[model samples]
Target: DLKMLYSAYAMEVLSDGHLNDDKLAALNQLRNIFGLAKYEAEAIITDVKARVFQTY
Candidate 1:
Protein backbone atom coordinates (compact mmCIF):
# COMPACT_ATOMS: atom_id res chain seq x y z
CA ASP A 1 0.00 0.00 0.00
CA LEU A 2 2.74 2.43 0.90
CA LYS A 3 4.67 1.39 -2.16
CA MET A 4 1.64 2.01 -4.29
CA LEU A 5 1.25 5.43 -2.79
CA TYR A 6 4.89 6.18 -3.38
CA SER A 7 4.66 5.00 -6.98
CA ALA A 8 1.61 7.13 -7.60
CA TYR A 9 3.29 10.14 -6.12
CA ALA A 10 6.37 9.49 -8.19
CA MET A 11 4.28 9.27 -11.33
CA GLU A 12 2.65 12.54 -10.51
CA VAL A 13 6.01 14.18 -10.00
CA LEU A 14 7.29 12.76 -13.24
CA SER A 15 4.24 13.59 -15.29
CA ASP A 16 5.97 16.64 -16.70
CA GLY A 17 8.67 14.44 -18.17
CA HIS A 18 11.33 15.95 -15.98
CA LEU A 19 13.11 14.85 -12.82
CA ASN A 20 15.15 17.78 -11.69
CA ASP A 21 17.30 17.71 -8.60
CA ASP A 22 14.59 19.29 -6.47
CA LYS A 23 12.12 16.72 -7.59
CA LEU A 24 14.59 13.93 -7.07
CA ALA A 25 15.25 15.21 -3.59
CA ALA A 26 11.54 15.32 -2.91
CA LEU A 27 11.17 11.77 -4.15
CA ASN A 28 14.02 10.70 -1.96
CA GLN A 29 12.22 12.15 1.00
CA LEU A 30 9.11 10.26 0.00
CA ARG A 31 11.16 7.10 -0.38
CA ASN A 32 12.52 7.51 3.11
CA ILE A 33 9.07 8.20 4.48
CA PHE A 34 7.87 4.95 2.95
CA GLY A 35 10.82 3.07 4.45
CA LEU A 36 12.00 1.97 1.04
CA ALA A 37 15.60 0.96 0.56
CA LYS A 38 17.79 3.07 -1.72
CA TYR A 39 17.82 0.36 -4.36
CA GLU A 40 14.06 0.03 -4.19
CA ALA A 41 13.65 3.75 -4.65
CA GLU A 42 15.99 3.69 -7.62
CA ALA A 43 13.99 0.84 -9.12
CA ILE A 44 10.78 2.76 -8.73
CA ILE A 45 12.30 5.87 -10.32
CA THR A 46 13.70 3.80 -13.17
CA ASP A 47 10.35 2.16 -13.76
CA VAL A 48 8.61 5.48 -13.85
CA LYS A 49 11.20 6.89 -16.24
CA ALA A 50 10.76 3.93 -18.57
CA ARG A 51 7.02 4.38 -18.62
CA VAL A 52 7.38 8.07 -19.30
CA PHE A 53 9.85 7.47 -22.08
CA GLN A 54 7.56 4.96 -23.75
CA THR A 55 4.93 7.63 -24.15
CA TYR A 56 7.31 10.19 -25.61
Candidate 2:
Protein backbone atom coordinates (compact mmCIF):
# COMPACT_ATOMS: atom_id res chain seq x y z
CA ASP A 1 0.00 0.00 0.00
CA LEU A 2 2.78 2.38 0.96
CA LYS A 3 4.72 1.35 -2.12
CA MET A 4 1.75 2.16 -4.29
CA LEU A 5 1.33 5.49 -2.59
CA TYR A 6 5.02 6.20 -2.97
CA SER A 7 4.83 5.44 -6.68
CA ALA A 8 1.95 7.82 -7.11
CA TYR A 9 3.73 10.50 -5.12
CA ALA A 10 6.89 9.96 -7.11
CA MET A 11 5.03 10.41 -10.37
CA GLU A 12 3.55 13.65 -9.11
CA VAL A 13 6.75 15.06 -7.67
CA LEU A 14 8.76 14.10 -10.69
CA SER A 15 6.39 15.90 -12.99
CA ASP A 16 8.35 19.03 -12.19
CA GLY A 17 12.09 19.51 -12.01
CA HIS A 18 12.17 20.14 -8.27
CA LEU A 19 10.57 19.15 -5.02
CA ASN A 20 9.53 22.36 -3.34
CA ASP A 21 8.20 22.86 0.21
CA ASP A 22 4.61 22.54 -0.93
CA LYS A 23 5.42 19.25 -2.62
CA LEU A 24 7.13 18.06 0.52
CA ALA A 25 4.13 18.98 2.61
CA ALA A 26 1.94 17.10 0.20
CA LEU A 27 4.25 14.13 0.49
CA ASN A 28 3.99 14.19 4.25
CA GLN A 29 0.25 14.36 4.00
CA LEU A 30 0.32 11.44 1.60
CA ARG A 31 2.48 9.46 3.99
CA ASN A 32 -0.03 10.07 6.72
CA ILE A 33 -2.90 9.16 4.48
CA PHE A 34 -1.24 5.88 3.57
CA GLY A 35 -0.38 5.16 7.21
CA LEU A 36 3.28 4.90 6.36
CA ALA A 37 5.75 5.01 9.23
CA LYS A 38 8.18 7.93 9.34
CA TYR A 39 11.09 5.74 8.46
CA GLU A 40 9.26 4.26 5.54
CA ALA A 41 8.46 7.70 4.23
CA GLU A 42 12.04 8.77 4.69
CA ALA A 43 13.24 5.74 2.78
CA ILE A 44 10.94 6.50 -0.13
CA ILE A 45 12.06 10.12 -0.18
CA THR A 46 15.69 9.09 -0.03
CA ASP A 47 15.25 6.74 -2.95
CA VAL A 48 13.52 9.41 -4.97
CA LYS A 49 16.28 11.87 -4.19
CA ALA A 50 18.84 9.39 -5.40
CA ARG A 51 17.01 8.77 -8.65
CA VAL A 52 16.42 12.45 -9.28
CA PHE A 53 20.03 13.32 -8.64
CA GLN A 54 21.22 10.38 -10.69
CA THR A 55 19.71 12.05 -13.73
CA TYR A 56 22.16 14.90 -13.35
Candidate 3:
Protein backbone atom coordinates (compact mmCIF):
# COMPACT_ATOMS: atom_id res chain seq x y z
CA ASP A 1 0.00 0.00 0.00
CA LEU A 2 2.73 2.42 1.01
CA LYS A 3 4.81 1.51 -2.00
CA MET A 4 1.84 2.24 -4.16
CA LEU A 5 1.73 5.80 -2.94
CA TYR A 6 5.43 6.17 -3.45
CA SER A 7 5.18 4.65 -6.94
CA ALA A 8 2.51 7.15 -7.81
CA TYR A 9 4.81 9.94 -6.79
CA ALA A 10 7.61 8.36 -8.77
CA MET A 11 5.42 8.12 -11.80
CA GLU A 12 4.56 11.77 -11.58
CA VAL A 13 8.22 12.60 -11.63
CA LEU A 14 8.83 10.23 -14.50
CA SER A 15 6.03 11.72 -16.59
CA ASP A 16 8.64 13.90 -18.23
CA GLY A 17 10.42 10.71 -19.35
CA HIS A 18 13.48 11.36 -17.25
CA LEU A 19 14.64 9.98 -13.94
CA ASN A 20 15.27 12.85 -11.60
CA ASP A 21 16.39 12.86 -7.98
CA ASP A 22 12.89 12.79 -6.57
CA LYS A 23 11.94 9.77 -8.64
CA LEU A 24 15.06 7.90 -7.62
CA ALA A 25 14.49 8.63 -3.97
CA ALA A 26 10.90 7.47 -4.19
CA LEU A 27 12.01 4.21 -5.78
CA ASN A 28 14.65 3.56 -3.14
CA GLN A 29 12.20 4.23 -0.35
CA LEU A 30 9.62 2.01 -1.97
CA ARG A 31 12.14 -0.78 -2.23
CA ASN A 32 13.04 -0.42 1.42
CA ILE A 33 9.40 -0.52 2.41
CA PHE A 34 9.06 -3.81 0.53
CA GLY A 35 12.05 -5.23 2.46
CA LEU A 36 14.14 -5.37 -0.64
CA ALA A 37 17.83 -5.38 0.24
CA LYS A 38 18.76 -2.67 -2.25
CA TYR A 39 18.45 -1.77 -5.88
CA GLU A 40 19.77 0.56 -8.51
CA ALA A 41 17.45 3.15 -10.04
CA GLU A 42 16.67 1.15 -13.18
CA ALA A 43 15.66 -2.04 -11.37
CA ILE A 44 13.39 -0.69 -8.64
CA ILE A 45 10.47 -0.05 -10.99
CA THR A 46 10.51 -3.66 -12.12
CA ASP A 47 10.68 -4.80 -8.51
CA VAL A 48 7.64 -2.72 -7.61
CA LYS A 49 5.61 -4.12 -10.48
CA ALA A 50 6.72 -7.68 -9.77
CA ARG A 51 6.35 -7.59 -6.01
CA VAL A 52 3.57 -5.10 -5.36
CA PHE A 53 1.26 -4.62 -8.33
CA GLN A 54 0.77 -8.32 -9.15
CA THR A 55 -0.32 -9.19 -5.63
CA TYR A 56 -2.65 -6.24 -5.42
Candidate 4:
Protein backbone atom coordinates (compact mmCIF):
# COMPACT_ATOMS: atom_id res chain seq x y z
CA ASP A 1 0.00 0.00 0.00
CA LEU A 2 2.32 2.68 1.25
CA LYS A 3 5.22 0.96 -0.43
CA MET A 4 3.41 0.97 -3.73
CA LEU A 5 2.63 4.62 -3.40
CA TYR A 6 6.22 5.41 -2.58
CA SER A 7 7.42 3.25 -5.46
CA ALA A 8 5.27 5.19 -7.89
CA TYR A 9 6.47 8.44 -6.45
CA ALA A 10 10.03 7.22 -6.69
CA MET A 11 9.54 6.47 -10.37
CA GLU A 12 8.20 9.96 -10.93
CA VAL A 13 11.18 11.43 -9.14
CA LEU A 14 13.47 9.43 -11.38
CA SER A 15 11.56 10.20 -14.55
CA ASP A 16 13.86 13.09 -15.25
CA GLY A 17 16.68 10.58 -15.62
CA HIS A 18 18.71 12.07 -12.84
CA LEU A 19 18.45 11.86 -9.06
CA ASN A 20 19.66 15.24 -7.89
CA ASP A 21 20.15 16.02 -4.20
CA ASP A 22 16.91 17.97 -3.97
CA LYS A 23 15.00 15.11 -5.53
CA LEU A 24 16.71 12.69 -3.19
CA ALA A 25 15.67 14.85 -0.28
CA ALA A 26 12.09 14.85 -1.46
CA LEU A 27 12.16 11.09 -1.77
CA ASN A 28 13.63 10.80 1.71
CA GLN A 29 10.85 12.88 3.18
CA LEU A 30 8.24 10.84 1.38
CA ARG A 31 9.87 7.63 2.54
CA ASN A 32 9.78 8.79 6.14
CA ILE A 33 6.19 9.85 5.80
CA PHE A 34 5.31 6.48 4.30
CA GLY A 35 7.15 4.75 7.15
CA LEU A 36 9.53 2.95 4.83
CA ALA A 37 13.05 2.30 6.02
CA LYS A 38 15.99 3.89 4.24
CA TYR A 39 17.25 0.65 2.78
CA GLU A 40 13.84 -0.35 1.51
CA ALA A 41 13.37 3.00 -0.13
CA GLU A 42 16.83 2.80 -1.62
CA ALA A 43 16.06 -0.66 -3.00
CA ILE A 44 12.82 0.53 -4.54
CA ILE A 45 14.45 3.64 -5.98
CA THR A 46 17.34 1.63 -7.34
CA ASP A 47 14.93 -0.81 -8.94
CA VAL A 48 13.00 2.03 -10.54
CA LYS A 49 16.19 3.61 -11.81
CA ALA A 50 17.29 0.34 -13.32
CA ARG A 51 14.02 -0.19 -15.10
CA VAL A 52 14.10 3.37 -16.36
CA PHE A 53 17.60 2.88 -17.71
CA GLN A 54 16.52 -0.23 -19.54
CA THR A 55 14.15 1.86 -21.60
CA TYR A 56 16.90 4.15 -22.76
Candidate 5:
Protein backbone atom coordinates (compact mmCIF):
# COMPACT_ATOMS: atom_id res chain seq x y z
CA ASP A 1 0.00 0.00 0.00
CA LEU A 2 2.81 2.39 0.88
CA LYS A 3 4.64 1.62 -2.36
CA MET A 4 1.46 2.11 -4.36
CA LEU A 5 0.83 5.46 -2.72
CA TYR A 6 4.40 6.52 -3.35
CA SER A 7 4.16 5.56 -6.99
CA ALA A 8 1.01 7.58 -7.41
CA TYR A 9 2.65 10.53 -5.66
CA ALA A 10 5.70 10.24 -7.91
CA MET A 11 3.49 10.39 -10.96
CA GLU A 12 1.83 13.51 -9.55
CA VAL A 13 5.20 15.15 -9.10
CA LEU A 14 6.24 14.28 -12.64
CA SER A 15 3.03 15.74 -14.06
CA ASP A 16 3.46 18.87 -11.96
CA GLY A 17 7.11 19.57 -12.82
CA HIS A 18 6.22 21.83 -15.71
CA LEU A 19 5.29 25.34 -14.56
CA ASN A 20 3.55 26.17 -17.80
CA ASP A 21 0.27 25.06 -16.28
CA ASP A 22 -1.47 27.26 -13.73
CA LYS A 23 -1.38 26.17 -10.09
CA LEU A 24 -5.01 25.13 -9.90
CA ALA A 25 -4.74 23.00 -13.01
CA ALA A 26 -1.49 21.42 -11.88
CA LEU A 27 -2.96 20.63 -8.45
CA ASN A 28 -6.12 19.19 -9.93
CA GLN A 29 -4.04 16.94 -12.14
CA LEU A 30 -2.07 15.86 -9.13
CA ARG A 31 -5.20 15.17 -7.10
CA ASN A 32 -6.67 13.08 -9.89
CA ILE A 33 -3.45 11.16 -10.48
CA PHE A 34 -3.08 10.41 -6.78
CA GLY A 35 -6.77 9.54 -6.30
CA LEU A 36 -6.80 12.18 -3.59
CA ALA A 37 -10.32 13.42 -4.38
CA LYS A 38 -9.31 16.98 -3.50
CA TYR A 39 -6.78 19.66 -4.32
CA GLU A 40 -4.62 20.94 -1.45
CA ALA A 41 -1.55 22.32 -3.13
CA GLU A 42 -1.63 25.56 -1.21
CA ALA A 43 -1.52 23.83 2.16
CA ILE A 44 1.06 21.34 1.02
CA ILE A 45 3.31 23.97 -0.51
CA THR A 46 2.98 26.13 2.57
CA ASP A 47 4.03 23.27 4.85
CA VAL A 48 6.83 22.24 2.56
CA LYS A 49 8.12 25.81 2.32
CA ALA A 50 8.00 26.15 6.09
CA ARG A 51 10.02 22.98 6.49
CA VAL A 52 12.55 24.00 3.86
CA PHE A 53 13.00 27.39 5.48
CA GLN A 54 13.39 25.77 8.87
CA THR A 55 16.27 23.71 7.50
CA TYR A 56 18.20 26.86 6.59
Candidate 6:
Protein backbone atom coordinates (compact mmCIF):
# COMPACT_ATOMS: atom_id res chain seq x y z
CA ASP A 1 0.00 0.00 0.00
CA LEU A 2 2.80 2.37 0.86
CA LYS A 3 4.58 1.53 -2.37
CA MET A 4 1.38 2.23 -4.24
CA LEU A 5 1.16 5.61 -2.57
CA TYR A 6 4.74 6.38 -3.54
CA SER A 7 4.08 5.11 -7.03
CA ALA A 8 1.14 7.43 -7.40
CA TYR A 9 3.12 10.44 -6.29
CA ALA A 10 5.93 9.36 -8.58
CA MET A 11 3.47 9.08 -11.41
CA GLU A 12 2.40 12.66 -10.92
CA VAL A 13 5.97 13.83 -10.62
CA LEU A 14 6.83 12.10 -13.86
CA SER A 15 3.58 13.01 -15.55
CA ASP A 16 5.38 14.93 -18.26
CA GLY A 17 7.56 11.92 -18.92
CA HIS A 18 10.56 13.67 -17.50
CA LEU A 19 12.39 13.52 -14.16
CA ASN A 20 13.93 16.90 -13.73
CA ASP A 21 15.90 17.99 -10.65
CA ASP A 22 12.93 19.80 -9.13
CA LYS A 23 10.75 16.79 -9.60
CA LEU A 24 13.45 14.61 -8.09
CA ALA A 25 13.60 16.88 -5.08
CA ALA A 26 9.84 16.76 -4.69
CA LEU A 27 9.86 13.00 -5.02
CA ASN A 28 12.64 12.82 -2.48
CA GLN A 29 10.62 14.87 -0.07
CA LEU A 30 7.66 12.60 -0.55
CA ARG A 31 9.93 9.61 -0.20
CA ASN A 32 11.02 10.90 3.18
CA ILE A 33 7.43 11.50 4.18
CA PHE A 34 6.65 7.90 3.28
CA GLY A 35 9.63 6.70 5.32
CA LEU A 36 10.99 4.68 2.44
CA ALA A 37 14.72 3.99 2.30
CA LYS A 38 16.70 5.36 -0.63
CA TYR A 39 17.17 1.92 -2.09
CA GLU A 40 13.47 1.12 -1.91
CA ALA A 41 12.51 4.43 -3.42
CA GLU A 42 15.10 3.99 -6.14
CA ALA A 43 13.61 0.64 -7.11
CA ILE A 44 10.08 1.98 -7.22
CA ILE A 45 11.15 5.12 -8.99
CA THR A 46 12.97 3.08 -11.59
CA ASP A 47 9.91 0.95 -12.24
CA VAL A 48 7.59 3.93 -12.36
CA LYS A 49 9.94 5.84 -14.67
CA ALA A 50 10.08 2.89 -17.02
CA ARG A 51 6.32 2.60 -17.06
CA VAL A 52 5.77 6.31 -17.45
CA PHE A 53 8.28 6.52 -20.29
CA GLN A 54 7.24 3.34 -21.97
CA THR A 55 6.39 3.81 -25.66
CA TYR A 56 3.60 1.95 -27.41
Give the per-residue lDDT of model 1 (tens digit) for 1-56: 88778889999999889989999999999898889999988888899889988888
lDDT over C-alpha atoms for residue 27 of model 3:
68
lDDT of 4 by residue, 1-56 (tens): 99889989988888878989999999999998888998999899989999889877
Write down the TM-score for model 6: 0.87
TM-scores for all candidates: the values are: 0.92, 0.78, 0.42, 0.93, 0.37, 0.87
Per-model clash counts, in order, read 0, 0, 0, 0, 0, 0
Q: What are the per-residue Cα lDDT tens digits for candidate 5 across 1-56?
A: 53345334444444434334564476566556655533354455445445455655
Provide the lowest-lDDT 10-residue window in model 3: 47-56
Residue pairs in candidate 4 whose N, alpha carbon or C atoms collide under 3 angstroms: none
RMSD of each: 0.7, 1.8, 6.9, 0.7, 5.8, 1.3
Q: State each model's CA lDDT, in order.
A: 0.89, 0.78, 0.58, 0.90, 0.49, 0.88
Q: Which stretches of candidate 6 lie over 4 Å from their true place?
A: none
- lDDT tens digits, residues 1-56, model 3? 65566556565555555657876776676667766555443454665445454444
What would you estimate as the lDDT of candidate 6?
0.88
What lDDT would candidate 4 get against the real structure? 0.90
Candidates arranged by lDDT, highest first: 4, 1, 6, 2, 3, 5
Off by over 4 Å in 5: 1-29, 35-39
- lDDT for residue 52 in candidate 1, whole number 0-100: 85
Give the poorly placed runs of model 1, Cα more than 4 Å off. Answer: none
Quote the positional error of residue 2 for candidate 4 in Å. Answer: 0.6
Residues 1-56 of candidate 6: C-alpha lDDT, one tens digit per residue: 89899999898788788778999999899889889999999999999888887842
Higher-TM-score candidate of 4 and 6:
4
User: Which structure is stronger by TM-score: 1 or 3?
Assistant: 1
Off by over 4 Å in 2: 14-17
